[model samples]
Target chain A: AQKVTQAQTEISVVEKEDVTLDCVYETRDTTYYLFWYKQPPSGELVFLIRRNSFDEQNEISGRYSWNFQKSTSSFNFTITASQVVDSAVYFCALTPPIYNQGGKLIFGQGTELSVKP
Target chain B: EPEVTQTPSHQVTQMGQEVILRCVPISNHLYFYWYRQILGQKVEFLVSFYNNEISEKSEIFDDQFSVERPDGSNFTLKIRSTKLEDSAMYFCASSVTGIYNEQFFGPGTRLTVL
Candidate 1:
């Protein structure tokens, strides 16, 4: 069984503050994929990032950054200088390699972030 | 950028009634999928379709659920009987290729079973 865990159910941060959302996953497969998705109040899921198992490098995209650590089985997301617009629900998900399965994503419970101005 | 689209943004049906949720994937995409999210819950994958047939399905997808691509552009999920527990937001997604490709998601349809 594969599982993703987002322990922080909710986080409140003032504008310009840096916040980190933690994600932990469990999977027996050696090759798999990890993802981060954002669901705004509009109810549509917006894809944020995808990290495969073999890559341990930290990725940064503008205000967002992801740290993938295989040793701890953790993939943490950080928002630098978070603004009010960053308020939304963030989900961390895991999936097997394409050939292993039908690309089914097993998602975390989700962390709801509230960026207050 | 071409995006996936779904119809009937919101649908309310009584228990035991049948409902069909429709989606139009990106024109060149080859894989289609259906997922659902109950209120305040994580999204769960239901099924994935490719080559005009179901390639994968979760336990949540049982005999009551069926998927079809009746036309070239349209993919549909039909629920033979609705239950109160069936109320959730259904999302349709598509990917150009299944390997290491990110799937584009639709706005989703909220189904309310009364």
Candidate 2:
């Protein structure tokens, strides 16, 4: 079974504060994919990032960063100086091996972040 | 930038009535998919379509659910009998290639079952 777990149901932070959202996954396949999506209040799924099993290098884009550690089975996301606009639900997802046509995205319960000004 | 688009931003229907949600995937993309998210719930995959056929489907995509690419550009998802549980935000996504590529999602259609 392939599963993504986001343990934090909700988190609150003041504007310009740094916050980290944790994601843990379970998968049997040696080759798989991990993803993070942001859903704003408008109710749209916005793509954040995607990482493969072989890539353990951390990634940073502007104020957002992702740390992928296969040993820990975790792909965590960090937002530096989060603003009120960052208030949204963040989801972690896992994709099956290459054979399943990019397979269905198995998603975590998602973490709702509320950044206040 | 090419983005996926969906029609009927909001739809309200009776529990027993049928409803069809429409989507237009990005041009040049070959794979299409459907997903849904209930209020305050996580997103769940419904089905994946390729070559005008279903490549995969989740357990939640039961017999009541069906997908079709009626024309060259439009893809549709039809619910035979809308149930209260079926009320959710239906999202359409497409990817140029199934593997090693990201799937782009649309604004989504909010289905409200009364």
Tell me, by DockQ, which candidate is best. 2
lDDT of 1 by residue, A39-81 (tens): 9989899999999899999999999999999999999999999
Candidate 2 DockQ score? 0.73
Residue-wise lDDT of candidate 2 within B73-95, one digit each (tens)? 99999999999999999999998
Looking at model 2, residue B17 earns an lDDT score of 97
Mark the regions of model 1 whose C-alpha exceeds 4 Å error after superposition. none
Minimum summed lDDT over a 10-residue window in model 2 chain A is located at A97-106
Worst 10 residues of 1 chain A by lDDT: A96-105
lDDT of 1 at A51: 91
Q: DockQ for all models, in order? A: 0.71, 0.73
The TM-score, computed over Cα atoms with residue i paired to residue i, of candidate 2 is: 0.98
